[model samples]
Every structure is written in structure tokens, then in C-alpha cells.
Target: MQVDVAILIIIYAYVTTLVVLWFLMKVRPKFPSGISIGIVVFLGIATTMAVVTILEFAIAPVGRPASRVISIARGLKIAAIEETMKLIVAALGILIAKNEAKWVDTKLSLAFVSGFTFGITEALFYVARNSYSLFGLVNLFLSRLIHPVFTVSLVGGILLFRYGKRIEGVLVASYSYLGHALLDHYLTACACYISSAVILLALASFAGAVYLLMPKIEAERKQRGEFEKEATVELKDHWLNKM
Candidate 1:
């Protein structure tokens, strides 16, 4: 009902960063099949919401940040639910393609594609239910946009697991979850101290991280033939789609 420092900063930074991501993804990017992407999007929204709702009710006395311990606990719970639900959708193609000896481009693409769609779908619902005004739009950016952007950070992590980097994969996965959880916790419990500058800084840092790892993901994409036939040779990191 009320906008706070954290809310304002999140909205502004998210909207700006999303614009940048759109531009980056425009670079002769290879998109997923229409049917596959559509299925993943539907799966992402339906499963994520359904499972989150079930968990919320099952837990009861949901974390309201009455205390730091409670806040962290709640934040971890939320992170666990979100990560697991998203992964479930991402795993579909992989599970079906498990028998294939060769690499499946579509399976790998599923990770980011599902992530991107899930972020947008969730954002739309959140805006409609909470606020559809300017404030609502900002909320959508924060709540919806960030999830997919953050999940893009998982490209390396997923690859690590796909290839034989078990330890590294676990480490990356852990870091990703903690990073996502910490952001949520801070926004929920420490909103009063957050600022637009801080939000911008976080987004800039994330964009930089994406820029750094995109090459590795694209390298794999190319090796696996996951990209469109027509594309730019040099890939520059603009923002996020990494879904």
C-alpha cells in the first residue's frame, strides 16, 4: 500500500536494467522454438505459483520479519521454493532427453527460456493483483524482471552440472541461491535503509557479472548449435535474458 525507500529503488533500477537487457538480447540472438518456449512459460507460471502457494499455507505463520532470524529463515524458505520450482520446469527437456548420448541444445536452452518466461509471467500477475499504476509497473520490474535476470547468472552453474563439474556446480548454485535470498531478505526486512543509488549499484554489478559469463554460455551454445543461424560474431553483454 505504501512505497518505501527499497521499493522505489527496486522499481527504478529494475525498469532501467530490463531496458538494457532487451537491447542486449537483440543481438542476433537465437530464440527457442515457439512451441517449446510456450510450454515452458506456461509450466513456469503454473508450477511456481501453485507450489509457492502450497508452501505458504503449509508453513503458516509466514515470515513477517518480526526478527532477523525469522526474516532469514523465511527468506531461505522462499528462495528454496522458487529455485526448486523453476528448476523443475527447466528439467523437463533434459529428463526426456536423458537417454541421448549427445548434447541437446533445446534442453540447455530450456534453462534460460523458462527463467525468462517465468519472470515475466509472475511479474504480470503481481502487477495485476497489487498495483497496475506506475507503482505497479515498477513493482512488476522488481518482482518479475529480477528473477529471470538472476537466473541467467546460473548458466555457468548449470553447465558445470551438465558437464562433470559437480563441486563447482554446487558452489555456484549455492552462491546463486544465497545471493537471491539475501536480496529478498534485505528488501523485505531492511527496506528503510535501501536507496536508489544502492539499487542501481546492485543492478550494475549484476549486469557486469552477466557480461563476463555470457561468452562462456554462448560458446557452449554455439558448440551445441543452440543459436540462430544468423547472428553477430561478437556478443556483447547489454543486460539479461539469460533466462
Candidate 2:
């Protein structure tokens, strides 16, 4: 019982701290007013819950006592459902708020928050419904941590779309889904007493995902910086004219 409490506390603390930091440093200043930002945050959380519920129902048809091939297919299906829902939610959020101008600044941050919420919520749900030993708990924690990286690919797709590369954007976005499916495949393989070297493939895939995501983040950050500079100049001009 004590162990479970400690695990819960650790998970909560980690999640809360990351969220608070993102909100304060990344999200808060990007919006025009508190109310708008609140709406975005609320929608993100709601989207996470919706995704989790949908995934549970969607995967139920996969059933149990599966062969290795069937297990891998299930994993791919899970990845497809999750990544699709996330991408759709993020895209909808962008379209609904895209006219704000500030919406572009929040794109990456919002995606991160949504993905973070999804991963943590899904992890907690898994913890609640299953028993885990110490090693298993550690593995679960590590696995959940990587889950958010998939959103980085979504952001890349969004960026490309905004830049008028629709087809390329879609293919780039699907990268996350494929990466996620690969990780799930290896994990399922390991569970079935397959050679553990497959874990290396998972790690490599994660590293590759991160590598692919970095340039997109850098591009977004540079663009946001430019936007802030322009806004600052405009505000100064307005004050000077008023004077």
C-alpha cells in the first residue's frame, strides 16, 4: 500500500511540475487573454480523456490469446487509433483558433500539453487496472515517458501544413504513428520471450523520433521569437503615437 502511494505521488508530482512549467513559460504569454488560454487548456485535457476512452473501446475487438502476428497487429491498431485521435484533436484546435495569430505561437506548446496529458492519464489508468512489481513499475514509468515524443511528430506535420506543404505534412505526421507502432511491436515481442535485442530497436526509434522533432521545435521557436519582436515594436509604436 505504501509503495502504491509513493508511486502515485511521484507520478503526480512529475506530471504537475512539467505542466506548470509549460503553462508559465510557454503557454501563458502566447494568448491574448486569460479566458482564451483557459479554454485551450481545458480543451486539451478533455481531448486526452476522450482519446483514452475511445482507445479502450476501439481495441476491445482485438481480444486475447493472440498469436505473435496478431499481437503485433493489435499494437499497430492501438498506435493508429492513438496517433490519429491526437493529430485530429490538435488539428481541430489549431483550425478553431488559428485566426488569433497568437495561435501559431502556442502550436507546439499546446501539442506538448495535450500529449503529456494523454500519456500521464493513460499511464495512471493502466496502473489502476493492473498489478506491477517494482521492476514492472519502473518499466511502465519509462515507457510512458517516451509516449509524449509522438506528439512532436504531430507538431512537425502542423508546421509543414501551415507552410503550405499539405501532403508532406501528412506523411511527416504519420512518422509518429509508425514509430509508436514499432515500439509497441518490440515491447510485445519482448513479452513473448523474443530476443531482447529488440529493445535496442525501440531505443533507436525513440532517438530517431527525437532527432526528427528537434528541427521542427527549433523552427517554431525561431518563428515565435520573431513574432514577439514584431509585437513589441508594434506596441511601442502604438504608445508613441498615443503620446
Candidate 3:
């Protein structure tokens, strides 16, 4: 149960991000229901692990040392599993947000918060199982970032889909999946493919996408505000008339 500095940093990052998300959700006006947050968290963990495990077992022959054919097959399997998990998580997050309507903003925030929680928990498990070295800690830090980043991207897509652009949401989700898969592939080959240029490019792409979508997100917030005001008036009227 030895804890490395990198692991400590990752845990701190995850917790700090989550606390900020919580504060934002609370101070920003409206937020999702308790039930909705629970559902998103549950699906995030269940869907990702289920898909990863299934792909691992299905491609066992490919992962075997003796068969080059099997090795190639396993690689493809791993890629597919990773990409699919990203896409599914993103899509599901958006879908949940859509269902919650006015709570889309809070739901999106919670989705990423939940994702960070899952990533940190999984990293702890991985470090516990493996050797706890500086390298292992760095690996955990990078791996932990994966979940939050992917989730954030997915939440962005979901917000777009809820507003007026379903296609944009799908595109964002797809990009997140591909981006995650590429990052994972690169990291898996870090020993040989330690190219800072490539890593920076990928990070830039993700950051750029998020930046581009900020305005739309702000617009959505305004819309949610209007919806909340209308709902409050309606509720007040209904109760007054009943009284």
C-alpha cells in the first residue's frame, strides 16, 4: 500500500476538480436531480468496465505470445473496446442530460465529476495491484486524466445535442472516443513512441474543441435560466390556485 507522489497528485487533482464542479453546480442556479446524477455515475462505471472486459476476453487468442496474427487481432480488439467505451459514455451522458432538460448543465458537470471519481478509483486499484514507483505514479496520473477529459468532452456534446444540434453532439462524442483511443495507444507504446510533438498536438486538439464550444454552452445556460423562471412561476400559480 505504498503511495507515490504522482498518485498523490492525481488524487488531489481529481478531488479538487470534483469540489469545484460541485460548487459551480450549486452556485450556478439550477442543477440535476439526485437520481439523474446517480444514474450517470452508475452507467459510466458499468459500461466502460463491461466493454473493456468483454473485448479483453474475446481477443485472448490475439494476445497470446505465439501467434502474430492473434497479436494483431488483440491490438484491434483493444482499440475497438477503448474507442467504443468513450463513445458510449459520451453519448449516454448527453442522453441523460437531454432527459433532465433544464438540468443539462448540472448533469453535464456531474457526469465529468463522476468520471473523475471513477478514474481516480481505478488508478488506485491499478497502482495497488502493480509496483508503486514514480513511473507507475505518472502512468496513473495520465490515465486518471483520461476519464475526466473524455467525460468533459462528452458532456459538451450532450449539451449541444440538447440545444439544437444533434449532429454536433455526435461529432464531439466521436472525436472524444478517437482522441482517447489515440492517447491510450500512444501511452501504451511510450517506451518507443515518446514524441512530445504528437502528445502536444493531441492535447491541443482536445483543448481547441472545448474552447470552440464554450459560447454554445453559455447560450444553453441562458436558456436554462429562462426555463427555470417559467417553471417557478407555474409552480407558484398552481399552488396558489389550489390554496
Candidate 4:
């Protein structure tokens, strides 16, 4: 079958850009002012895409002829690298928020935004290459979903950080990387039906996990707000009593 690799690549590029942007708008209301957010988004996307591309090139040679098996291994390696980079970004976001005494939502949202921006830039670059056929395009589409799925894992890592267990955060980040790699390797190397089915299942699982996590994150944000307010009130009263 002459795989319409181009179509698949386009689909992936479109879907990933849409999902990441949608998530950013939905999760982060106070996303800077005007020019700053746009600039940050553009830079984030460019930087991440460059990093991913370099990583892919570096790892591709290890696979030699790029047979199905080797391609699968390469895909996994790329996934691991992408996820790891996203995780590091997420961790840095969390650490910054903690130091600044910012809300947890802000930290989580920033981390996801960085990831989404990264995905969008990568998608555009891949589509621009015009390298794939129908089958290749389909492969690209399926592969693109991994970005958001792995990004959700980064969110989970941020939550672990909120709970004051940085180790748990690291573990969550590593899990995201492994999950991404496993998914990519299997889908790229297996039979078409098997690969498509597994990708669908993974998407469903990712959606469900995100749904479950949202309420918990909201609750935590509210609780933190209350605690902050109470502490502020106590400080005010202490100052008044001293006066």
C-alpha cells in the first residue's frame, strides 16, 4: 500500500497544534499580557523542535538501515528524549512556582503550555519537510499523539511536586518518558491493526487520566487559596495587635 505519508503528517501537525493550543487556553487564563505570551510561545516551540530534531538525528544512526525493527527502536528513542526534555521543563516550572509562591495551577499550566508549544513547532517542521507518503503520513499522525499524552504525564509530575515529594515527581516524569517510548516503539513496529488499536487505547487512557486529574488539581488549588488567605489574615491581625 502506498502510504499517504504526507496526509498523515499533515493530520498530526494539525491535531497536535490544535490540542496543545486548546489546552493552553483552557488551563491558563492569565497567560501573560499580549506580546510576551506570543513571544514566549514562539520561542518555546522553536527551541523544543530544534532540540527534538537534533536528538532524532543523533539517535537515527544507531539504527543503521532503518528497517521496521530499527525504525521502531528509533521511534522509542526519540519519544524518550522528547518526554525527558518536557519533564525537565515541567520540573523547572514547578520549582519556579514554589519559589515564587505562585498557585499550583499556574505552574502546571505553564509546563503544559511549554509542551504544547513544543509539539506545534515540531508538527509544522515535519509537515514542511514533505517527506512522507500516505502510509508515512498515517504513521506521523499516530506518532504525534504521544506528545500530548506524555505532556499529561508532566502535569502529573507537577502534582507530585505540589504534594512535597520531589522524588515522586521524578518518578512520574520517568514514567511518562517510558510510557511514551513504549507506545511509540510498539505502534511503529507492529502490524497495522495492532498498532492502530494500541494507539487508540493509549489515547483513551490518556483522556481518562486527564479527566480524573482535573478535579483533583482544582480542589488542590482551592485548598491552597484558602490556606493562603487564612495566613494573610493571621498576619494582618498580628500586626494590628502589635500596633
Candidate 5:
């Protein structure tokens, strides 16, 4: 049953990734290169492995204990580790891209992919460790979907930092970390009363980040189209001269 649960979540993640890619490609004229997307996905998986390793060794492992405080602490630790890893990997992905300006055009999508992959990887780990019913695993998968928001927030923050808005960058990044910690803490502690509030807040943040990125994405798309037009014109002139 647990194995079935894991398979189901994995299938869902795969389909979700493809759908997102298709949607972005349809709506945007410019997208990140395949290599850049590949790197981000690889980094996302590596980030998950790093987190699991640290949790298993460096951090005090949290078992199925009855203590709420311990559970909260575990959650905080998880947030700290996972957020740090996501930030690092996201930045690394940007750095690895050959054309930073081109990457900026589809930064949000790349960030989403990274976070989505990371979240799914983490969820699979939990699925392996625990025996969950089909419904329970589905719920877990849904909750894990919030992860892309955190990554998008972090990437936006990093962009702000690079563009000289250091304070705002820090604040935005802090917001992502805070939302992630709260969700994890409440979920792990089984504080049902507050979970709904936390989830709503996280969703709101996700919506805001996407809203903020949309204008920038459109602007970049226009700019890229103009650049392509100019390039085609130049190529045509060169061909005429050759003829």
C-alpha cells in the first residue's frame, strides 16, 4: 500500500510538471533552455538528497514522538535546511545558465520546476518512511504543492538582491522561510485548528509572487521578440549581400 502511494504521488508529480511546462510554453514566447531546466531539476534532486543526509546525521532525527515542542522543533529544522538548500540550488541554477538575461525571462517557471521537483522528492521520502492510506498520501501530495511558491519567492528575492534591492530581497526571502516553517510546524504538530490559516496564507503568498512575476515575464517576452526580429533582419540582409 505504501509503495502504491509512492507510485501514485510520483505519477502525479510527473504529470504536473509536464502540464506546467506545456502551459508556460504556450503562454510565454521565451523559455529557459532545455539544459538550464535540466540543471535546475538535477539540483532540486540533489538538494533533497542533501537535506535527507543532514537530517539523518547532523540534525537530531524526529521520530513519531508525542511532544508537540519536539515536533515544532523538527519542523523548524526542516524549514531551515530545506529553505537554505532551495535558495542555494536556485541561485546555482541561475549562475549556471549561459545567458542570465534569457534566464530572467522565464525565471519563475524555472523556480517552480525546481521547487516542484524538490517537494516531490521529499514527499517520496516520507512515503517510504510511513504507511499512508491512498487518501492520506493524496493529501500529502497536495500539501507538498506549496513548495513551488517558496522557491518562486526565494528566486524573486535573489533577483531583487542582484538588482540592488537588498532589504526587500531579504524580507521576501524571509517571508518564504516563515511560511514554510509555519506550515511544517503546524502540520507536524497536528494542530488542525491553525493549519487552515497557514495554508491560506501560503497560497496567498504564492498568488502574490506569481502576480508580481507576470509583468516582468511579459516585458521580457516582448524584448526577446524584438531581438529575434532584429536578428532575422540582419540575417536576411547578409544573405542578400551574399547573393
Candidate 6:
């Protein structure tokens, strides 16, 4: 019986990896396989966790909150902090890669990979505490997938800024931050007060949202690359003509 269960778990892991890889291919055709991109993801995760640790220490301590409203407010602050962290790390990673003069594929791949690292790291930490049983896997995966995808959804803002769309980038980044905060607020608040079933649905919703939006991001990323290349060429030609 134990052997049978073990075999089943192995099979499940294999299937899960294949499915995840398939979806990843859809969202990013050549992602989860790039070494440098994986490095950026690792760095992004490290940066986010380290910075958040400092932020928490710097912030004032609050006693057990007086009301649900206060608790909710604190949760919202957490969301803001985390969402901001993702943006900052992701943008920083992109800039660093750009400064290195990596191609558009590397730059574009880093954004999503970094965002995914953040989410998967979060999932891993939670799973460590809970330890997985069959019942826990779905909740575990969904919960882990949501936030990174949230950040992935907003990678457009950072990409735009990289392409000289400063105003648009800031606007989109702000919107992304607010949306992340709201989603986190809702999920955290409900999880505290509601059933696991609702939490499951919320997780699924967030993941679905990311899956649906990825193609559009692919379009935007492609279009922005073309625009930036054109501008760069124009600048180069102008300088050469002047010389």
C-alpha cells in the first residue's frame, strides 16, 4: 500500500511538471528553461524577501488590532508592500539586464521568470509549514501561483518604461499595485473569516486571470520591442550622419 502511494505521488509530480511546462510555454514560449533568466528570477526573489524583511522591522509595531477594520487595513498594507516589492525587484532586474545589453528575448524572459520566482517562493514557504497531503495540493498550488502571476500581469508597466514609455509605465505600475493590493486584501480578509472553498475559488480566479492576460502581454511586449528598436536605429543613424 505504501509503495502504491509513493508511485502515485511520483506520477502526479511528473504530470504536474508537464502541465506547468505546457502552460509556461503558452505564457512564455521559451521560458523556465533559460539559465540567465532563472538567475534573475532567483535574484528577484532574494531581493523581495530581503527588502520586505527590512521594511517590516522598520515599521511601527501594532498590538492586536481593535477591530476587523483595523485588521483589514493592515492586510491591505501588506498587499501594498508585497506588490510594490514585486514591481521594484522586477524593474530593477530588467534594468540590470538591459544595462548588460541582453537581447529582447532575455529581457522579456527575465520579467516573467522573476515574477514567477516570487510566487513560487511564496508557495514553497507555505508548503513547508503545511506539508503536503493530497487534499492540500490544489490549494497549495493555486495559492502559490496567484501573486507571481499578479506581478506578471503588470510586467507591461516596467517593459514600457524600459522602452521610453515613462508616463505609461508609471500609470500602469500604479494600477497594478492598486489591483494587487485589492486582491490581496480580499483574499486575506476572506481567508481569515471564510471557508477554504472560497479561498480556493479566489486562487483559481487569480491564476485564470494571469493565464488569460499572458497572450496580450506577449503582444504588447512584441510591439514595444519594435518601437524601441526603431527609435534606437533612428538615433544611431542621426549620430552617424552628424559625424
**Alpha-carbon lDDT, every model:** 0.54, 0.54, 0.52, 0.55, 0.64, 0.51
The TM-score values for the models, in the order shown, are 0.63, 0.58, 0.59, 0.58, 0.76, 0.52
Model 5 poorest ten-residue lDDT run: 57-66
Worst 10 residues of 6 by lDDT: 57-66
**Could you tell me the lDDT of residue 232 within candidate 1?**
35
Report lDDT (Cα) of residue 200, candidate 5: 57
* Reference-based TM-score, model 1: 0.63
What shift in Å separates residue 188 of candidate 2 from its native position after superposition?
2.4
What is the model-wide C-alpha lDDT for candidate 2? 0.54
Best by TM-score: 5
RMSD in Å for all candidates: 9.8, 7.4, 7.1, 6.8, 6.1, 10.0
lDDT of 3 by residue, 1-243 (tens): 223333333333444345445435533524356665566667666765565445432211112333222233354555456544544554455566665534444554665555665575566555555565685476455546556655655666656676676786777656555554544443344311322333334344434445555576578778877988999999999999999
Number of clashing residue pairs in every model?
A: 1, 0, 1, 12, 0, 0
User: Could you tell me how far off, in angstroms, the CA of residue 65 lies in candidate 2 after the best superposition?
Assistant: 7.4
Q: Total backbone clashes of model 3? A: 1
Q: Please identify model 5 stretches exceeding 4 Å from their true place.
A: 1-31, 56-65, 68-74, 100-103, 160-170
Worst 10 residues of 3 by lDDT: 58-67
Error of 2 at 11 (Å): 19
lDDT of 2 by residue, 1-243 (tens): 355334433432354344435434533424334443455456656766776676562211112333443355676787787776666655555555665534444665455555665666676677777777786666455545444456645675656666676775676566667656654664433332221233233334333433444565457668778999999999999999999
